[model samples]
Target: MPPCNSTSHAVGGNTWELAVVWGVLYSDSAVVWGVLYSDSAVVWGVLYSDSAVVWGVLYSDSAVVWGVLYSDSAVVWGVLYSDSAI
Candidate 1:
């Protein structure tokens, strides 16, 4: 996982044949919400705060059931998904 500041939160997953799901939160940013799914696991939602970033798997199956917020230069507030096996 990458390094995050005190105001930032990050979630990461390392798996060989599974999927991961999670949430993230960031301060001083907009609000975001979404739903994601994986072949190995199911994620209903994720919430985050305080300059947090949402990161997902590179090759995981996913579906967006709602809205999502993302920004490279600004803080983000919402759910996050990552790698998982179950």
Candidate 2:
């Protein structure tokens, strides 16, 4: 197991926010995951797989997803799935 590093800072007007500025790598396969938030809502998230699959999501009033599958297929939607056919 590896140690996880995290930090928090004041955003403004006494509002403190904790943000993961970097992705946490788990195990030896090098899979990385990260998320960012603002005003109590998720701003964006990312997932990187060892097999060259990259997934990402963005939220702004509604959910939106943009991803690239292991087969190099591109997809866009309000939801995401690990299946390449999605």
Candidate 3:
């Protein structure tokens, strides 16, 4: 694996991978959440969350399934979103 920008960990009992960014992006204060991988080639992806996850740019080599659930909540996705796979 390449050097991460910050801390890293595994999810779903070593199923899905995750990384915790401890640095800021650009001059704007932000918590970078990166899904780092050696290769962007993937055919499957699944995300499960009880709250809400607002994603901006999603870089992937395969299809992605963003699953979310919440009560009395609002959600919206724009065309600028990148949800594609190889």
Local distance difference test, each candidate: 0.40, 0.44, 0.38
Q: Model 3 over residues 47-70: C-alpha lDDT tens digits? A: 223334544433444555333332
State the number of backbone clashes in model 2: 0
Candidate with best TM-score: 2
Runs in model 3 with CA error above 4 Å? Answer: 1-28, 43-53, 56-59, 62-74, 78-86
Candidate 2: clashing pairs of residues: none
Error of 2 at 6 (Å): 14
lDDT of 1 by residue, 1-86 (tens): 23322222233653244334343434454544433333343344444433345432232235433435554445554544444432
Model 2 error, position 73 (Å) = 6.9
* TM-score per candidate, chains pooled: 0.20, 0.32, 0.22
Best by lDDT: 2
Please give the distance, in angstroms, between residue 3's alpha carbon in candidate 3 and its true position after superposition.
Answer: 3.8
TM-score of 1: 0.20
Better of 1 and 3 by lDDT: 1
What C-alpha lDDT, on a 0 to 100 scale, does residue 16 get in candidate 1? 42
